[model samples]
Target chain A: MNKDSISKMITIHGVNGISLLNSENEALLSNIKDQQISEAFVFLSSVMPDLEALLAMGAVKQVMLKGAGQQNLSTFAHKKNTLCIQSDPLLSATLLGQQIRSAIG
Target chain B: MKSILTNTISLKDDEDSYLFHEGECLEFSSTKEQADQLSEVALFFDQFFSALRDSDLLYTESHIEVDHALIIANILKNGHILLTITNTAPHAHSNLQHKRPIIQTPRSLVSNKTPSKPLDKKPTALSESAQLAIKKILINYLGPASTIIFNDVYSKWGALEQPTEKSRANLLKLLAEELYTQDEKIKFQAKAEVILKKY
Candidate 1:
């Protein structure tokens, strides 16, 4: 990957089966909105219990869980430098996007 | 008993206008008129009384000594009406003054279900996983931040003391403020207050 390309993009991995795309064409992680994550988990767990296993396979650079709820999984991601965005999903995404864009520019 | 019909009923400024009785809230809202018309006010009271009568809920009205009765009466005097009614009961009178209302109804008319008994002891059983998760979450999120100095915030918040409508409102308000924006917090608080007032 070229340095310019790397500088212009960031990938967000959403634990608990959420995904969203950013402007740089980089694969944004799970698009689940914050308020919907709990309800989403209820559905996802019924289908498959191991969401973390599924997320680990993706090229998500950072993991953002909704709310302070992420404190449960922070230890798991600490080794990977998988920055945990503490705000609710939407607020985290917006803030993350701004931070990423600023870093790239 | 000579039940004196006082012209002005003193009501606290912050007191809820409508009281809930059974499963219904006896409230009146005027649409076009700046205030309720005397006839409209009379009709509203009539409906409330009629509902109680229809339900065979025997109640008695007693004079209350309130400081703001004249003030509230003035508000009602100018075309506004006083809408008061009863609310659901587990079958016993509650110590909460706002929760209990006086009406001219027979005691037998009330529901037969015994009022919920107060718990004798505080809940001490906590799921091991839940306790661990709470501790971990607190240490990770709030402990490091140190923005708040709470020794046992969760434990304190989780406890219930004489669960009244006012207490419930306070709990909900605290939760909303912590989790939501100012507007959302206000909306949540308002919704809780509405529910508490009704039943």
Candidate 2:
């Protein structure tokens, strides 16, 4: 595995309780249940409006919510060229972190 | 994926075994040979239903089975559990009163028993073994940072206590966290929860 690549960063957006992990599979941020898609987009747009620029600045990728069926959000993700992963509510935060790391690497 | 070794058979000649899943029909067979393949299938039913019960997926096993295939298909379609048995006979019959679907294997029998009260909708926490399994999966598959979120969500919802509105809320909260996080750990955990909830 490439150590430098492993250290890359990723942004995850969803409700507050969602687990967002960095490329290294580290828990970099998490949102509460009340946080919605609009809030996530606003946050991302404000912080990293230019996805390519963000990637150049050590951002490896972005993971967004695709809901349970992964039907609607998946299409949107594909259009935006973003990675969308679906998850259940009962999962632990740490597991999400590891998944991010593995996905990025 | 781990390969699990399960016991297939445990009966001698003339020994009879009966298999029943909460609401499913009873499978009965007099001789082990008479119910060989069917018994193995019945075992699968028992195991599958047992897992569902253990996970608190389905409250009562009251649904009657029309055949072994129906039971197997139901479980596979639902993806909740797996069952297997040594030997059994397949006996089909009809109930005159309610006209319910019934399947009677030689190893067991089915009756016209009414289902009990509906079970609570919430999912409790994971058992010690289940919790450990989750931990192992996280450590091995997810990384250290991801574990934190998983632990937080699990601590919040993964209880085996009585299912209630509060428990469901906690579970949903955990799921929302996983969706936002986009972590595999959360994904698998969420899948497990979904299975538990479905059953």
Candidate 3:
């Protein structure tokens, strides 16, 4: 997707920030300024492979984390990269995932 | 020593659900085929979360959706984690279907071949329609995530006892407790009572 569409995806309602990270855990494009949040997501994505192996079930489609006093953090695999979104806790992760998939597709 | 809270939550008949505290398995039930994977995943999560906590970012809850399952982890009041795994793969449905033949067997043969139990002794099971009705009531209060929350709690409720009137009432009470405010719980309880009357 182009930069404009990527920018539009982050502007979705309830979204606080968004980041697109490559396999190296380097942010390729992002709107989130908090390096801590970005690193947290990147670290989470890094564990997906180990989690999947431990599960022996299938690939990790998405992971959502909610801190006590912070915005909800969600990460999902999209094509070759990972998309991390920080949003309001009330936002439906499943619906957000669907929208992301459709937007990228 | 910390007292573990395991009395309220019950694993379903299929035993696919589990509850873990700290790094220990407090409650777990699953088929033989899934036991290994579940245990492995549990250990991995314990280590992973510990590592995450050391990083100075504390998350109280996590939800992981895999291609074949949904894993949910929550930190309880006692500083223990409640990890629940639900199999959502298509093949899991096939395993569920295997149980259908037992229920679909000829009733006449079953009645004739086995000693009949007293009607009052048998617990009533919830019909599909009743479950759907309850779900609708929940959706009004909890919105889209209501479905996932319902399924998780409903499985536990079903495992507690046969879905009789009393059990159904308890299910509503437990679900109502999920609401944040006392007023919402009261309103939810009232709305749920209407469904109970119909069921």
Best DockQ among the predictions, by candidate number? 3
Residue by residue across A11-101, what tens digits does model 2's lDDT show?
A: 3332123333343233334332333332333322222222222112233233222223221111012122333233443332235544555
Cα deviation of A98, candidate 1, in Å? 46
Candidate 2 lDDT tens digits, B1-199: 2111112234333233344343232343333333332323333333433332343234222111121211211243343222322122243222222332122343233254432222222333443223333433443333222334455566556454454544654554454555435575366666556544443
TM-score for candidate 2, please give it: 0.22
Q: Tell me how each candidate scores on DockQ against the true complex.
A: 0.01, 0.01, 0.27
Consecutive 10-residue window with the lowest summed lDDT within model 3 chain B: B100-109
lDDT of 1 by residue, A1-105 (tens): 234523333333332222222322122343335543323222212111112222122232332222222321110121222222323333433355455445445
| Position A20, candidate 1: lDDT | 29
Q: Name the candidate, 1 or 3, with the larger DockQ value.
A: 3
How does residue A100 of candidate 3 score in lDDT? Answer: 71
Q: Rate the local accuracy (lDDT) of all candidates.
A: 0.29, 0.33, 0.64
- Per-residue C-alpha lDDT of model 3 across residues B1-199, encoded as one tens digit per residue: 3223235454432224454543344444433233323544554555455555655667777888887777777766565566666667666765764432111112223354432211211234554334545655665566433544666677788787666766678888888888889998898889878877865
lDDT of 3: 0.64
The TM-score that candidate 1 achieves is 0.19
True contacts kept of 1: 0.00
- Model 1 per-residue lDDT tens digits across residues B74-180: 11222233443122223323433544223221222335533322121234333222222222222222222111211133335556555343455444544454532
Candidate 3, pairs of clashing residues: B15-B29
